[model samples]
Each structure stands twice: as structure tokens, then as C-alpha cells.
Target: MGISQSTLFRELRRNSSPAGKYIWFKAHDKAMERRKRSTGNATLAPN
Candidate 1:
């Protein structure tokens, strides 16, 4: 099935904030992307 409607709403409300979830998400995404790019570059470098 899927997430219950009430549970989804509760999570949205709980996580919502003017200075919270979205900022953290963007920061985390940027960090992960930077790490992946660095790792890929290292692998492709000539020894």
C-alpha cells in the first residue's frame, strides 16, 4: 500500500519550519553531490 494520509500529514507538519527542513535538505544534497564528484574525479585520475 502507501503511507497513511494522517501519518503523511503529521510528518509534513512536524518537519515544516521557516528555518528548518528545506535548508537542511539543500545543504545535505550539495554536500553529497560534492563528495560524489570528488570521488569520481579521483577514480578517473591517471596514476
Candidate 2:
């Protein structure tokens, strides 16, 4: 955690559910999905 408290809070806020509960699996899925979309691949490696 080199990040500041506010940065951590912002990430949690972004990945948290609309109902305002944090589910670990859902958050991980959301992150992976976003990663895929942003990189155009399932992982970070280039084609």
C-alpha cells in the first residue's frame, strides 16, 4: 500500500456494488473485465 488512504477508498468505491456492499469475487471479476476491455485481450501481454 504505497497509495494514500483516499486512493484506496476511491478504488473500493469504484469496484463496489451499486448496493454498496463489497464482494471480493465480484470486484475481481469487474477488474478483469475492465482490463480485458481496455487492453483488447484477456491479459496484459500484447498479441
Candidate 3:
């Protein structure tokens, strides 16, 4: 069976907030940088 819209919303609400504010922002920035590096093929190119 498929998940209901309300259930999905509730799940998103549950995990969206982080307890540590600094850690949350730091993690978000790190994740974005990691995505950019991976998608830009930085590892494949020579330094």
C-alpha cells in the first residue's frame, strides 16, 4: 500500500528539526558542498 499524504507530512515534520542548531547548519553546509564536489567531478580531475 502507498503512504498517505498526511503520514508523509507528519514524518517530514518529525525529522526536519534538529536539536543542536550549530550542528544542523554545519551539517547542511557540508552536505551541499559534498554534493557539489561529487556532481562536478572534482575527484576525477587532476589537482
Q: Give the clash count for each candidate.
A: 0, 0, 0
Give RMSD to native, each candidate.
8.3, 5.5, 8.6
Misplaced by over 4 Å in model 1 are 19-47
The total number of steric clashes, by the backbone 3 Å criterion, in model 1 comes to 0
Tens digits of per-residue lDDT, candidate 1, 1-47, equal 39899986665555556554545575566668877878463345678
Candidate 3 worst ten-residue window by lDDT = 14-23
Comparing 2 and 3 by TM-score, which wins? 2
Top candidate by lDDT: 2
lDDT of 3 by residue, 1-46 (tens): 3999998665555445575234456656766787787856346667
Best by TM-score: 2
The TM-score, computed over Cα atoms with residue i paired to residue i, of candidate 3 is: 0.35
Q: 1-47 in candidate 2: lDDT tens per residue? A: 79999988988899999999989899999989988878464656778
User: Model 2 has how many clashing residue pairs?
Assistant: 0
Model 2 regions lying over 4 Å from their true place: 1-3, 40-47
User: For candidate 1, what is the lDDT?
Assistant: 0.63
Order the numbered candidates by TM-score, best leading. 2, 1, 3
Clashing pairs in 2: none
